[model samples]
Target: MLASDVCPGEETIAAYVARKLARDERDAFDSHLDTCSACQELVAAVARLAPSQSADPVTSIGAASTITQAAAEALRLPGAQLGRYSVLASLGAGGMGVVYAAYDPELDRKIAVKVLRHARAGDQLRDEARAIAKLAHPNVVAVHDVGRADGDVFIAMEHVDGVTVRDWLRTPHRVPEILHVFEQAGAGLAAAHRAGLVHRDVKPSNIMIGNDGRVRVLDFGLALADLEPGTIVGTPAYMAPEQQRGEAVDPRADQYAFCVALWEAVAGRRPEAGGRRPEPGGRRPDPGEPGTLEGVPDRVRRGLRRGLSARPADRFATMDELLSELFPPVPRSRRWM
Candidate 1:
């Protein structure tokens, strides 16, 4: 018997319905489930009911992430190979599935693949795969392939070798270096927002730093429509106030986060637990967060302050504006060649 049989009331109903939908299409109502605890609990229950197929202990950073990691660990099957790609090792897990480092023998390529566990084995995974595949940008990580193998749904993407923005901030860097990183990151976010996608979760962990000193955004799993309020998403520290209350959002939301990240990078301290303070003439100066713009060029500091505006409308309308300010077009000499 399934766990749905033992659950009471709406939980059972939600579980059965979700499971059915998950069987049909895993991504169909992922945004729906992310916000609904009853549904999330049901999904968690279904995962718990599934027998353990592997002996590995699921290691994760926090409580909310455990559900996804544990679920991925349970769904791992034996001797399953797909389309010239061999699964090598588990990278990490998120709210919905497990990502693994896979090897492609035919082209001699390495890829990071995420597979849905439990009810996410079907359409839900497909939808996320499709949504992410549509976005092709240098700063935005690309989705290479999506399909199913041995009853599990999978997404194969470019494997980036780098540390997260969170990892980079573990130690202090020169203020100038921090500013350059923030400028690049803001450019990426602006590009994605322009394409009509909202990255619901934009914390330090989701930002990857390449060995070449480039910053890229990862995990569009929680992305949604700019105006929708379906799922209450994002980590608390980096999450905007509206996200916590399940309200509408847009590019400005991303801009706000970019500012916060910049703040943390430069100041090396989390912003105080208060909303953005308003300023006259539609401008607000840095709240004197020590070293916020210390050692950075004044031009970049002005842009960062604008992007972090409490009101979305008051911030840069597009990432292009922010990038141009951060990295002005420098003329190159033809004689160099």
Candidate 2:
């Protein structure tokens, strides 16, 4: 008997293929594997051994198209409906869970929902959900509801329709536009820091620019209330040296990431990761200023340099400090409204 014939389980092969191909190009292999019973059995065996913990018992399907094989055998779970809301479509998937765009029939609004894929082996979902719920800020995406359904943990949050700053920067941004983003991001970080939180992940991908010209910081999955050691949960490209080393990090780590992102936007190329900048034509710019950014202004370049300082002490102590220097404290009533 084939693996499918021997192993009888509810987890389907189509879901398995979708999860596996989540990051790679979607192709015929996924479709064929979905219909092959032998392949399905192999997938089931492998899934049992894999470290997957989905919030829903059903498997995740990536941005791949449907094919005969997968379409024929894939099991379709009911769309998630919690309280007065119904999940409409998948937005994206993170390390531990997936985010969805959901409709609330009672309020007649769309909300963002994050459901845990698998409960942590040690920690309860309630604990994590409560921690996240405490965060409330205009700039930070708000957590409205959190709970479990059919053993799957979920969180309903305010949805902001937007594109990530990183995606927006794939094309060049004008100097003013870049500065606008930095200013708003700095303010958001300042608010979170004041509440005794540090956003462990501070990359372009985590910063969003909405169609309404508002900037909102997204994803607090890696955020923590207190600075601590031993959590390795930030994106490698944007992580501070201390974070990568698993050392205790403070708000300065976020400043470092902020500077790195600013540099990428202004400099038009990623700064060398190890810092030092290869002597830059044998003479570094004045202590807190960069020599080049092609088109970025002097004030913005200076700020970027300070944020990317080699030593944490050299960086701004708080996002507020950075924001004050970039944008004065006065409220932009006209622009904001």
Candidate 3:
């Protein structure tokens, strides 16, 4: 049931598929699982073959996370080994899986390893990897590598040592600074759009701010193409009307989410449910419900209002266009030399 017993050309992982072992022995196997990336991936492979394993949670989501934390502590990843990277510490865990700050000996740099929980085919993983690999932009967090480790599919990504856009908004910032940050984020989305990709999820939490003062759009996990209608994807408050209606989403959906994030950043609150968009024929929506528009410029507010329009057609055609409306380039006169 453990990697040690089976790793040396013995019975395969299939032989240990969710096998019941003694409590002490299970704990020991879990310890081995912590360091052996190969074994971890093996577990993931079996999980794919038997999806029911994940459905059996010991308790609620929060309790599961607590148990996961306890398990991690017991393993204590210090000097922990993986395929090609040494795990330094656990950065955080989300619905998908756990992420660790690791050191890549070959690259001689720090990287983030995201281990996805679900089982996806190798071909699918490779295709997604290829697409993400092509998206190389300053504003987009780079995906350095992707491969199966042991049994889990892990993504090696460029680590940005900083806070999320959500947390960043909690700190005080000037209007210009806010606009600048959002512009950079918009650039990332624009890049994705040009590559024929729509970032279905564009909440503030998906945006990362590096300590180097660079704003990057992260997590393309939900950015899949041709999602069937009725696919409920994205955060509710930040979701576009079309998305809520279960219609196929496009770049305009991202525009709507961007507007929501910007609005929250400025107003310090999300747009209420049933809130109407700023459309001429639609019911007039209160632009002041989230409180005074102090420090929010008229141009910025107007752009946000339009982007937040319920109809996708009413919103900005592209992320770049939305940015241009919010920040038109200043004309420069050249002196005759």
- Candidate whose lDDT is highest: 3
Between candidates 1 and 3, the lDDT winner: 3
Separate clash counts for every candidate = 7, 5, 6
lDDT of 1 by residue, 1-337 (tens): 2232232333333333233334223332442443354445435433443344233222211233454454444544433465557878666554455667888777789887766543333465456556678877777777788776766556778899999887788887887677667666766677677767777677677788887767788876555221233655555445555554567877667766766667667766545424443343333447345645566667667777777666677778776787777667779868865
Clashing pairs in 2: 53-117, 53-118, 54-117, 55-116, 55-117
Instruction: List the candidate 1 regions with Cα displacement exceeding 4 Å.
Output: 1-84, 116-131, 149-153, 224-229, 273-285, 288-293, 325-337
For candidate 3, lDDT tens digit of each residue in 1-337?
3454444111233333334344334434543543465555444434333344354332221243343344444332757766788889776543345678899999799998876655347576677677787999999999888777766667788999898887787788777887888999999999988987777879888899999989999877665222345746455557787886678888999998898788777667665524444344332355544644577777787887788787888888888999998887879998899
Better of 1 and 2 by TM-score: 2
Model 2: worst 10 consecutive residues (lDDT sum): 22-31
Candidate ranking (TM-score, best to worst): 3, 2, 1
Off by over 4 Å in 3: 1-82, 119-122, 224-231, 273-292, 333-337
**Candidate 1 C-alpha error for residue 40, in Å:** 16
Cα lDDT of all candidates, in order?
A: 0.60, 0.60, 0.68
lDDT of candidate model 3 versus the reference:
0.68
Candidate 2 deviant stretches above 4 angstroms: 1-49, 52-78, 82-84, 117-136, 150-152, 224-229, 273-291, 328-337
In model 1, which residue pairs have backbone atoms overlapping below 3 Å? 25-123, 25-124, 26-122, 26-123, 26-124, 27-123, 27-124
Per-residue error (Å), model 1, residue 333: 9.5
Tens digits of per-residue lDDT for model 2 on 195-309?
Answer: 7667777878778888788888877655422223474555544556676567778898898777777777776655652354324221223324335676665566667667666
